[model samples]
Target: MAYNDNDGDFPGETSTAREELRAEAREVLCRLVGREDADFHPGQFEAIEALVADRRRALVVQRTGWGKSAVYFVASLLLRARGAGPTLIVSPLLALMRDQVSAAARAGVRAEAINSANATEWDQIRERLAADTVDVLLVSPERLNNPQFRDVQLPDLIRRTGMLVVDEAHCISDWGHDFRPDYRRIRDLIAQLPGAGDRRVPVLATTATANERVVQDVAEQLGVAGADGSGEVFVLRGPLARSSLRLGVLRMPSPASRLAWLLTHLGSLPGSGIVYALTVSAAEDTARALRDAGHEVVSYTGRTDPEQRAELEQALKDNRVKALVATSALGMGFDKPDLGFVVHLGAPSSPVAYYQQVGRAGRATDHADVLLLPGTEDREIWRYFATTSMPDEHRARAVLGELEAAGKPLSVPALETRVDLKRTPLELLLKVLAVDGAVERTQGGWQRTAQPWTYDGERYGRVAQARLAEEKLMLDYENTSGCRMEFLSHVLDDPEAAPCGRCDNCAGPWFPTGIDETAKGSASKALGRVGVPIEPRRSWPSGMDRLGVPLKGRIPEESQVAEGRAVARLTDLGWGGRLRTLFTITEGGVQDAPVEQDLLQGAVQVLASWEWAERPIAVVSVPSRSRPQLVGSFAEGIARIGRLPYLGSLELVDGGPRGESGGNSAFRLASVWRMFSVPEELASQLASARESGQHGPVLLIDDRTDSRWTLTEAGRVLRGAGASGVLPFVLALNG
Candidate 1:
């Protein structure tokens, strides 16, 4: 049967021809899949039609099992018929790519995936691209980033490329649930692809969740103009209510009891499910215990090989494995629609991560359950990692001593030679130290975590305060006083407009009485009409600025002038406290003499490099605005520059030389520096480096206009000096 042309935009003969081709394609797909009608969601057909009709870019954000693949598949089929060249779909996971290839084969669409495991995959993919045999090509970001793939010689294929679809699009956002540096580069690669007659290929970016900032960032990075165009965007909300999924949280008094409870529950629960542990050892031990208890269980962690992962997935799919104990590695894109349950043996670091993992169950319409097991051990583990995992003074000093004694910067391998820990732990230590300003990593070697281990209690205090603030944000999400689902949706920017009634708090009564009942009782009592005082609805302030503690005024002018020379004097006098405590300079006559600004700045750099300060200020710019706004603007800029790894713990201040800001203020200039291993330290530095006359390569965030601002040569000099534990001050107007 010929399908009618839903719209008349396709012109006389072309319209008739395209309609005939679509019908043929549909028939072919149906026959290939051996189905009378494709089992697709209602919206799937509409999305496909929109994609084919519109010549511009588009994004489709739909729920997990809502046939997102079909939308792209149908579009590819239509594009091929229209003589468009191969379509490329960049996937975040290898398994997802394989699944799409399998689905396309079933639908009679010629598609293939280039992944790492297969030896001949790259060559075959390249051949297909060159021969124009592949209608659609699926690839993981890692595969696309491979130098071999980038240098592949093919005709101006991008110009003929019909569609570039990026799945799991949230990875483009730094604030997303899954943040990957490699994913951020996809935008540049897409932009480099040759477009139809100099016109960019119609790009389509899709994901389950894309917040406002994320959406903007993704569009900008991909150079897609905006969310609206011929390449428009459509967000399809999935049914949040999974009534068949039973949700329960168990609180155990001890870790041993929690383990025991896990064993007991696994034995009692019927059908296949997942037990999510926080660590590799936990997953292994839990699986072992479950097996000992006579339960059919498998385990998976980051260490699991691809072959094993495939086997485990197959076993789960075929119902051969009754239960699988896993870590976070098993959550993303492992689509087992018939998952019976998801049990968290320990508390997840964040609710967003927890929800995503639990949501994996019941994708195929079967009733599923989710269990959260929080025990003392779990809490202890969380607290320990939250507080102590990162680098500190002693650790930094040890690393520095080792490096100095060796008389050279240490490579990853050489550093491993000195450290007793495994590679992962060592990397984590290095990362934390880098963030703490204790170390600097070169292209091929590592420096000390910080300059030296000098205690500055005041500096540590500020760092501690910052850490506390961060902890509070996490705590607010975990608090049971409010609806968990509502809190999470609001925080994570989920587009669902209404409260999800499926979560534990929403499903169960929050209080003895309903909200209306409580309100009525309170209203009556307030009116003195014989009732109870209205139960106050608790509220927490939203936005980071509202909750952040304000910083004190910039360090004194004399202290700034004395800088490191004065600091060295004090250190020599044995006035060392916690690193955070040395914010002010003491006036002990000779000890208080202001040293050259350069010397003082150099000392400050030394302290910062030594990890004695929260951040190393290569340049400080004083702009006339609130610190919060400045921090936010800088973060946006960093994301734009594709420098997402250099953001953490930012502070903004309302300081600069009045309406007439200083011309040479380090705060007023733009400077570039490589953010080695320090993610958190970079965030703090960007935040704290906001003050008039502050020496270093910093920019004054002018509230008047939004444009690219540049830093002076002096500012660049300071950035260089700071590279060697010195601060340079420069200033420039907001030209």
Candidate 2:
């Protein structure tokens, strides 16, 4: 059989030829892999064809068990035969690397891994690579970070590296489901490689759970732009549905009852499966209890020995271990297609985490169950895990202090010492804080996460508190929600038309039916307030305005607006207008009113009335190309303020050039800060600034740049705090 590329221009010939080629390719792959017939879904085959003919770098987001690895394997063989150079596969897990290498060897292709597995024979592997005897090299991100690897002359030996593949590329994004700081540096390494200059080496990124942002981040990080544009990026819709897997929520009245339910379920569930415990000790103790109950059980956690982990993985694969109770560590890279069940003994901190853990079941084919056993103490445990040790105020102050002292990159250890916390807690706190732009980690040490704060402590604290509260509330929602599957799906932003009928809530008679979506909307509306209005007609006529606040009836430009006059006019109107508008209102009888009040009362009220108040705002604060440092500083300020109550819901918006350049920009201190500043603070004089649903109160930190802050209803409320113009307020700083 023969195949025609998808890029063909003639429809009839393209269709006929492509069919023939696909048949030929399938036969070749089946023969190569020793399979009777290559079994794959339609979606999987289409993805393979797209990748084969793709001109630009591409990403394959096939769901687990969709034969993504097979696509690459076939592509690798074809590319090598066509003299495209050896393929370089970068994977995060050693086990996965080993599996691919073994499969390749079976297909009569030369494959080798340069990891700890071959530590004793590293020189031999290097020799094989240098001699061009290896067809593919499976490596880890850590290996690429090695200084010796950076200095190596292997680029000359492997001058024609065909394809660069990054598996689980979402790790490049700090906000990804799984974040690894080291992954952020992979862009640099890719940039320095040959063939990755003007035209980047063809890159293939693969992941199962990457969201839109993550997909973009992966493409940028791997120097592959426009790869996902052709529907080549497959996203399997709908929740994982398996009827054989019993969905159960065991609500234990007490710890004793919870333990009893766990034991009963573990004993009764047939086939091997995972039992996820909330803590390390819980996992171990539960495993011990199961062992005592005459079941072959093993426990795994962060502290588990490497050898033990290997043993457990092998045992599970071989069906020797009946059950494995573990923390979240085991779910990441484990691919057991026939997992019978996944029992969560307690609530995970976030719905994303829960979905990931539950997804491990029925990966290859649907016939598994996910059991959520929420004990009375599970809520408390989840809270403990979600809550940051440092208050937002303390974190903001500490971050600023560190930045002032170091003036350079500082590692986590150094920051811990300065912040006066134990290493583990401090590290976790820093990671959380970093998400909100409170602090940033560098080669040296952690620095202030956001731009240097021009605002006082109270303002900074408000922003921080808002952010922390939102994170905690999200966690709380997960713990308390009645529909576990729905909650998980919501967090993932999956738009399934209907709920999974197989979930615990859906299957049970007690499923929550009375909960109306409108009820939530009503509650939000009831709590929201409308702000005073700034008559637009009165505020805009001013020839010049500082902030466009109406003076008399006209707004003035900053050049003409006096600070004192602007403040007086805003106070008298019980609202704040732009400085420019306020100047006009004071100088001329243009019937000027407060711009802040008009914006708050009008924009916020409209948003709230339209029920778009809760929609997440995309905050873009990166300055134009001319002002890079200001972009960074502004981003930092945004991130710092993103942690506040009314501000934390905003999404960081990035609009940088595509590919590795964009990915690298995401990690830059300034870029991160800008990304974190989606929900900025608004000036107080806007009457409706405090109105619920108005998307306002956003602040851009770069004073020199033309920064625009759009406010949401929540943001308006925060902005209303600056009713008196004398309250020197930055747009988002405590608002």
Candidate 3:
């Protein structure tokens, strides 16, 4: 393989040049897969041509198994041979980056990655980059703006970079189903690259799932013009419908039915594959239910530790387990050619998202089963996620005002004291704001930038509306009168969408709709199982002094509450839906009602099963502004049933805690600081219990636990008043 410098410093233009490039790519492809017959798929060669020869921005929209990775590896090697710098790839997830790096190595491409999982290797990677020994450099989107990388390493990489590849490029569009704020930073990085005819750095972005709207948005962000405009960008789109997928929908009446169906029928599917749930609790509970039925299944969600996630992925890939009951986080960049099926316990909010998840199965197999079990509760879950993605105007302004008022960098915790937003949402808003040039993250913390910022209310509103429309489209998909795969492809704007004859509508339901009654009973039992221990707060939140609360450091052991119990987390599969209904806040305030009979029975079951050092000797209630009657009755019922005396409730002074629910620790802690005190009469009664050799933990009851700060603060006050120990009992755990 040789290049002529006199061939005008450009690789391909005439048919002869293209033929030569394709021949070389074929040779590299054979070396990559170790198969002499390996060749490019339909659009792969065109994408390579655009990047290597045309030196233009290109986006590839093809099916999951279209060999998108081969194009990039071949392009990188081809460019490197011609004296171009190493390719910079902005991958989305750490696991995905690892997969890419491994694949590149098989092609004999020297690809190195910098991610959260590898700190020690970074130095070695930097050395390789400095020595010009690395062919490709992979980093997560989050790393694009990291203090060290953005300030130190990125400028030089951008200057000499031969190609920039954005894998999973749909994330760049806010209108897309899975949008990340950090992904928008690529636009800025793209701007810094040289932009001339031949000297411009070529860029390639690829994804399997992006509608026409998303594709246009992503292209605009990448500075790529579509076919309607000047020929600045080249987009190679292929049919997204997978011929091997046999699709169907099983309408389960309830969560129990859904689990029972899975427990009864999972093995009937071809072989090992993925089972997706909408929430972590659902995934865990479903996996447990399946395991209890003698099925080898494991749970994979965002909460699964990164190390464990890798192990689990490998476990599934190796067929060591029957299935991985997972959430949406498991879908992207995972590859297993022989995966047999995909079963969704609940549907995703958009057709695009559903297609991406189902695309995981039947990639290389002759046949793979894809089934959806739709639940009535899915819309509520969709609404919860929808609320988080868009930035709250008030919250954004408050963050900017705090940073501007301070006139310096403040850590997130410091900002939390002054702003009233939860940590996750606050962090997401900061990323969005940072990309918009409102605030900038630095080594010290976040600081206000000189760039003026506008709220862009109309833009966010349009995005929200577009999301709602997508949700409606998803619902329509459930009851579609046409082929399921064709519907999904039409939603994604695939030009060649046609009825997939394998679907239930096309060929009749190939899946069993019957579930075993025994499985249903077992699933109900699993969902109904109660009692999750709430870990006690051992230390106070920092930056509390800013809120005028003089609390810091480890709390005294005597004042710390013992580990508490809740009937279940609010996100639990079985009890969670009911609890959510009971605590549903209306336009005015939370409803004040007594404990429901079934929940009271559940509480009694929790107490009977509790393995306590000493059972609670007495019960005391926390002051509740929104649900006083509910908390009062719950405490009284527990005290009566346990044969323990019911002490008086704690007294709320100074208008009872300030602010509303759902904020960061410092703000939440300070809002409830010094807000409660033990009643004198109750204090005397508790003191009598301790004096009379009844030195057991007294139960402290509350309706719910969000931050657990209320329990900690109340426990401190009760300890001061002479309670020997405090044991917390709550109706629900918020998170």
Candidate 4:
């Protein structure tokens, strides 16, 4: 359905040249697929023609399995045959790089990759590039900014590169769901290619998940069309609809019920594929439950060790596991052509992102099932991730000011001391600032750039609004009466969108919607299981002295708190919802209420299961300005149940905790250091309790433990007051 633009005059548009390139491309294509009769798909030859013959930058917006990789692989061979230098590909994932390198071998083209995982091969790859033996070289987008790679090898590659390909090209655009600041470096890479017309380094950018906005944004950003209209880019776009996909949604009442549906019906679907979750804890917890049910499954998340991730991915590829319960981190660049189905335990925030994930299935098969079991907590988790990632102006300014004042490079840890942002968000903020020209990542760490930057509040606000709108659209997709495929097509601006007559809306539920009581009970029990141990901190945070706190290295053993217990995580499947409700109801301002009956019972169960060396004889609560009554009553209830003395809360003095939540560890420690002291009566009792060491350990309790600094400081105060030992307990762990 693509109309030939023929709007620009460039090299190799001649009929003779086109005919010859087409014939040669078909030969390479046949080799790629191991089929002597194989030929280009509708847009593959045209895309290759655009890149090789015309020597033009091109954007191919096609569905997955539409031969996007084939076009580039074939084009790279053709360009190499023409005496062009190596094709340098900017891929976004190591899995993609691995797959690309292997695929290139089918066509007998040499390909190599240098990533964080293969640091030892950097030398060999550099030698191959110098020897002009590598036909295609793949690397992550983040690698473009590496101090050594940028200064040492990038310049030579840029000067002699034949063609450049950006896999998962949507990462470069802000409008895309999986946007990354490192991807913006592709613009700079393209700029440095150095040539015009026939001598130009023809570029190819490919993706399956780009919408119209993402398409246009990427096209503009990749220099497909310059702002001054000096260059032209050939764009080949096709429909996003997939006939192989049979989309459906199965709604469940609660998280337990949704998980129960999976436990009962997963094997009934089809072959091995993914079960996506919205958070890491949910992914890990769900995997454990599935495995406990005797399913051959494993969890893949951001927390999964890098080497193990590759093995897990291979396991799914070989169909050794039933499925990998994973987060969105498992997405992008993973290729499994004949995957049977993809299930979501909860809905992703955007339908566009959902399409990208579900598209993973049925790639090489005639049919694959895609189902969603929507949960009530889906939107809340979506909003948490959406808002937390946005860069703050105050934090941005603080980072920039420190870099400017230092007059030299500053590492991330050093910056943590001067700025309050956590490692993840702070790194993200630095990337955003780097893209905006306010700072640059250099040898030691980061340095302020000479370029000026102004905070764009309006732009950030608009993006946040877009995310909210997308969240609403995701809800609509969950309950829609229209064709689900067509709805997704329109969401992604697919021109050929039409009712497939295959979804639940069109055909009245093609999937099984029943779960037996046994399955539900198993799932409920798995979710109901609670109690995560809290590991006590052994050392004080660095740079604490700068915050007017005298602490360094390891904490004194006499003052260190013992290992504690948390009832559950805020994102846990079992006790998470009740705990979330507990905290959310009291989030806006200070409020006082006793612990609810159900949660109190859950806490008791945690205590019963806890293996203690000695039973505590006293309970002391941390003073909570926001939840005094809750913490106080919870402590008092524990004392009443255990027959222990109910000592008062440690005193809050010297203007209590200096900063808000989400600060770095250094600031968090500084905020709580010396902020608590043993009250007179509590100290008197603690003194007598430890005089003969007959009172045993004191149970320290709080509503939540964030940063764990408050508990550390409070325990230190109690130990100084003569308690033999301190034991900490909390309702939730705010990871």
Candidate 5:
């Protein structure tokens, strides 16, 4: 709650007018919060006054939990009382929209939202809006681009809208921590909004995390161009410090050690909160491990189903679980007032992102803990996300070319046939292009725009450079000996950045680094447990017939590989660090060293734990040009240990091609089609091995399985040669 503080007053206001406005705001705020004595924070009343009194555009850059939502809800009430139409809030996340709806109702404002998850309620909500019953309407930025919403409904809503609120306004700026292309459309929405005579519609943009640059960007976006082509924006910035949070960083030796520390210490933390992991696999793995350790926890990631995510959110709010092992999915718009702690299994690439996640804790509490368990692989993960999200000129141009050639709107799947990019990267590229005015989304799909589009090379370069700078700042944060809270505030360009006297640096390390040996053993054992099943590819790639490959439809069951085992995922808590190093490319290529004892032991454990119906009669290596030594030695060792014959390596013929790291299944299969061949000697050996024991399966060993094309093709050839079955065994599975 932004308590009514009188020290900061609205400028250019008479004492008499200020008092009257304050009294009115107090009554409304009380109703909104359901507290008779509810008060506004220092600048909250000024923001509300700007919207309700002056009808001006305002940007509120305050700390999280500073009641940014209150300004809008209260202002909407005042505006509605004056015969203004319903308030239209453009929120980013569905979770945030749900919370805003609930919050608005408490204030007695009839609020409703139309989102993907609640299609059944949209008609009812729209009818309510049409009937002048809804006082406030919450929508996602993505909704603004929907064909029906944009073309059919938005114009009428704009003409009648009382106020416009951009929640999490930082998203409108590319410099912000979480940038969404959908947010760029909000600028156009604001520009097209009906003005009140000479004044613009009262607009309020609120965000908890924004540096000076982001603030300026958002302010510029909020301001509409006037007849004279000039506009003014009012900004209210408050201190970014969270006094209740005690921040600290703990550098862990490995992923397992970090989990071990969490297992040993999570119970001792202040209260139920979030444990953030960098990737979905990490979150699910950590959550499973913690649950096995007898902690009540669940994993929340982008992959989680929508209804399940809602349930998980409520579960966490109810404190039914100790914590949610979550990715950034649980972030933004979540309103847990008494969250006790936030622990990061890995450091975010930017301090701004770090602040956003940690801000979730201690929102309404006297004290809360924020800890970052930094990992050595943090930089690698950062680079992966950065590079993948960055715009590629080549890909963007390719998308435009495909759209132009089609001469009509083409759905994403239809365009996939004409473009070389995968669905995810392709969709991202299209979104970037849409924001750049290169393409326009239509009812059918997306069509090329006649508006000239140029790749802003300089802008892209600057974004990339800014990301690297943020990474450097995060490193500085992790290694800083100064006040942790102050360090974060400085990175956010907080004007009042100073020691909070509550952080670990200011009060000395308040967290324990020690882990009990018993907990350590449990975490290690949990992590070391292997056997991620490799479900065989069910169907052949779609375009294989066009590529001169004699394959289509479902793969023949006789030729398909059986469900196999991997020592671990490259993103796993235990063997991930080691497997990553083994597969990592250097200046030349993978180091090409033999498999180490630890990994060998892990593979053996996988083999032992594997529940195979028929024991392997022979072992054959997938000939590796990159990791021949490792693959050969592993296969030979497995054969030696399991007492099976070494049936020799599959031949990698000269004319055949190998798949790259990532692509569509069709493209991947094309690259690896007929890539491996069974030599005559190897074929004879495989037949003999099969004949020796009622045609037992052959263990096909490889360095790693990325696309699984290599394993599939090898299995095809072996089964073609009369082998009963082929079982794939790999050192790691890449996601």
Candidate 6:
């Protein structure tokens, strides 16, 4: 391999040079896959030519497994041979980066990555970069703005960089299904790169899923104004259809029926693959249900540890497990070419997102199953996620006001006291603000910037409307009489959209709608098996001292509530759906109703199977401002069933703060402390029972537990009144 100094430097008149480059790329691709006849997919060569031979920015929007990675790996090799510097790739997820690093090695490219997981290896990687021994370097979008990297390493890399590749480029657009604020920094990064004279660094952005609007937005960002004031970008988009995927939709009557369907038919599905769930609890519960049915399965979600995720991914790849019940966290950057199925427990809010997830399957196989078991609660889940993604102008302004008033960097916790928002939403708002130039992060924390910030009300409104429109589009996808694959393709602006001839509608239904009765009974039993351990709060929230609560780390064991039990989580797929109806509110206010018989029976079953150290001797209800009848009936029913005395409810002191249902621990603790008190008569009875050793812990009952502060505070009052210990039992746990 040799290079003329002028090779691939000047653009627009290099037909011979371009042909030579493509020939070299073909050889590299062969080496990469260990095949002499390896070739590029349609439009892949054009994308590669734009970056390597033409020296122009390009966007490649193609389906997964379309050899998008091949284009970049081969281009890097060709450019390096031509005396260009290493390729810089801005990748999104750790899994994606790991896969790319290994793939690059096959083509004889030395690829290294700088990410959170490899902190210990960064010094070595930096040394490699400095010695010019690295052919390609992959970094997370967050690293682009990292304090140390931005101040030291980036400028040098920019001057020497050969090509810039933005993997998962859809993240750059606000309209994207998975947008991240850190990705917006790419535009500014491009502006800072040296572009003296007419020559500029070539950039290539790639995504497997992006609609027309997202494509335009990302292209505009990537094609930043060069030194010559040109913002030209070449885009090569192809059909979004996956020939290997056979799509179908099953409208189940309830969550139990869906679980029953999986239990009865999962093993019969072609081969090992993924089961997509909308929520973490759903994934976990589904995995458990499948495992209980004697199937080898695992659960993967955002809550999964990085090391564990790696192991799980490998387990799936090796076919050690039948399937990995997972959330969207397991979607991107995960590659298993022979994967045989992708089953969704609920539809995603957008058609683009659905396509992205389903694309994970049948990448290399001749056929793969794609089934959507749409749930009634899917729309509610979509609304929640949509609202969380959109920034609230009121909350944004409050954050800015607090930072401006401080005139100094403030930590997230310090800012939490002044703002009404919780930590997650607050952090998200700060990130958005930082991208909008309203505030900036520093070593200490975050500080306001000199840049004037105003709410983009109209823009945000448009984005919100767009989200709703996507929801509607997803609904259309579910109910459309037309081709499902074509509907998804049209949504992605694929000009080649047509009947896939492989989907359920095109080929007639290949899946059975009826579930076996035995499997249904087994699923119902697993879901109805109620009792989740409620781990007691071991420590108090910091800053309680400032609020006059006088609490700090490691709460005294005596003051702690004993481990308790809840009938179900509000996010659980089984009891959750029915329990949700119990809390539903009408137009004006809550529906004040007594406990339903079935739910009451479920609660009793939870108590019957509870593995308490000592059985509860008495039942005491916590004062409920809303749903008093429901709570009262639940407590009384428990007492009657156990033949235990009802010690009566805790007294809600007037003038005491009415506790909020949900918020951070600090505020929740302050609001509820001293608000609950044990009456003199019940206190005497409880103290007598403990003194006489006639009973064990008293069961403190509540309708639901969200923050758990109310339970903690009420438990403390009972403990102070000399009850042996306070054991909590609730109908539901709100995550």
Worst ten-residue run, lDDT, model 5?
A: 1-10
Candidate 5, 1-735: lDDT as tens digits: 121233366666477776887799889889888888778878888888878887888888889999999999999988898889999999988899888889888889899998999999889998899899999998998888788998999999999999999999998888777888889888888888766453458888999889989988988888876664334687888888998999998988988799999999999998899999988888988999899889999999999999999899999999999999999998998889999999999998889999999999998999999999999999977755555455788878878888898899998867765666788888877887887788888899999999888888888788878878999999999999999999999998887899999877888889999998988998888777787889899898665664567787898788899998888888776677678778778888678877788888888988998899888888988988777899989998898888888989988777566646676666777777777888999888866655665557889999888778888988988889878889999999986
Clash pairs (backbone) in predicted model 5? 2-41, 3-40, 4-39, 4-40, 32-107
Worst 10 residues of 3 by lDDT: 1-10
Instruction: Quote each prediction's TM-score.
Output: 0.55, 0.56, 0.96, 0.96, 0.95, 0.95
lDDT tens readout by residue for model 3, 1-735: 112112232343468888898899889989878899987776677778778887878888888988888889899999998889999999898778878888899989999999998888999999999999999999999998788899999999998899999999999999899899999999888878877755678888889999989888888878733333322556667889999999999898899989999988988878899999999988999999999999999999999999999999999989999999999989888888899999999899988999999998988899999999988888877765556466788888999999999998998888888898877888889999999988888998899999998988998999988888999999999999799999999999987889999999999999998989999899999998999899999998887888888988999998899999999988787998888889877887778889988999999999999999987789999998888889999999999899999996999989888888878888888878889988889988987877788878889999999889999899988888888788999999985
lDDT of 3: 0.88
Off by over 4 Å in 4: 1-14, 224-230, 388-390, 585-590
TM for candidate 4 is 0.96
Model 6 lDDT tens row, 98-193: 899999898799999999999999999999998999999999998876768877889999989988899999999998888889899899887776
Question: Which candidate number has the best lDDT?
Answer: 3
> How much lDDT does each candidate structure score?
0.51, 0.50, 0.88, 0.85, 0.85, 0.86
Clashes of each: 48, 92, 0, 0, 5, 0
- Roughly what TM-score does model 1 have, to 2 decimal places? 0.55
Error of 6 at 358 (Å): 0.3
The all-Cα superposition gives candidate 6 an RMSD in Å to the true structure of 3.7
Q: Between 2 and 5, whose lDDT is larger?
A: 5
Runs with alpha carbons beyond 4 Å of true place in candidate 3: 1-14, 224-231, 587-589
The TM-score, computed over Cα atoms with residue i paired to residue i, of candidate 2 is: 0.56
RMSD in Å for model 5:
2.6
Q: Model 2: C-alpha RMSD to truth?
A: 21.5
